[model samples]
Target: MSEDERATAEGMQTCWSDSTPGEIHASFSGHRTLCGKPVIEANPIYASRLGDITCSKCGGIAVFDEGAARTRVREVLDKWIAKGKLTPASATEMGNLAIDVFPGRAFTSRRKGHSWNKISTDFLLASGAATDKDASARFVGELGLAVFEGLQASEYQGKY
Candidate 1:
């Protein structure tokens, strides 16, 4: 391979395990698809192409912190609830707080369930965890921290 190609390949390898800024940005451009289905289609083309903003990896848009918000809020919350550090009522309260804190960004449950909620990244902006390029990175870092704390609390001790 050419020198530049070899260098890029090496860098890509690192990003595969621990993504870099450029890699994340580049990867974000491609839509996630699987089994002839797209997971995350472009918002604009979603309506015409895939009919929705579903993520090919998760089968749905995954909202914000549904499964992999990078922040792992749900996982942390689940752990806290499991360990008795947080109650379902409290978890619901946090979800509501998230909604109240980020009015338009919070995802509200349309169903008749008390556990339904929405996710948004507005907290990242509001908390100054990120401003531009580092927003997602900061959020992911926070998610890692949440997971760490949950583990420390013995909630997701062995589940991970």
Candidate 2:
């Protein structure tokens, strides 16, 4: 038999055996019922990770780095407040919204081992704040540009 066929046969045999050594089996025999009705089934995190549930639609398997996102959001918000563009309360609210909405982690290589927790343009669409999708994207781009400008200005001031 071919290697694939042999492997399939072995797997089938393993499934049929009652006591397979070095194999772990899932047991739901002791599940509790709610008022004589079957309770909803819920899998553990490891089970979900092992299954095909780690896709982007399911939020993926990335670790959340809330600290980094919070810091960046606070920095941007503070700069705006100092510039008189945003009131202190408004800055706080926007910073809270950003922390709540954006993912605190990403699986991109551009982060270089650091967490990619920055807010994305798609967040505007997801949060229903974008009347026009293109405009929202442009707004996010402009926000990024503004942050870069603020960084440059800070660096220029620090040089003196």
Q: What is the C-alpha lDDT of each candidate?
A: 0.31, 0.34
Tell me the spans in candidate 1 whose CA falls farther than 4 Å from its real position.
1-73, 103-160
Error of 1 at 6 (Å): 47
Give the Cα-based TM-score of candidate 2 against the true structure.
0.38
Model 2 lDDT per residue over 1-160, tens place: 2323222111211011123333222212213211112223434423432122122211211222334445666766676667777788976776655444333123221123332223333444444445455644443444443332332222211101
lDDT of 1 by residue, 1-160 (tens): 2323222111111111122212211112234322122233222322222112222221112222222232345765576678776688876566444322221122122111212211223434445555545634554445434533322232111110
Name the 10 consecutive residues with the lowest summed lDDT in model 1: 8-17
Which pairs clash inside model 1? 39-54, 39-55, 39-56, 40-55, 71-143, 107-118
Quick one: RMSD of model 2? 17.3
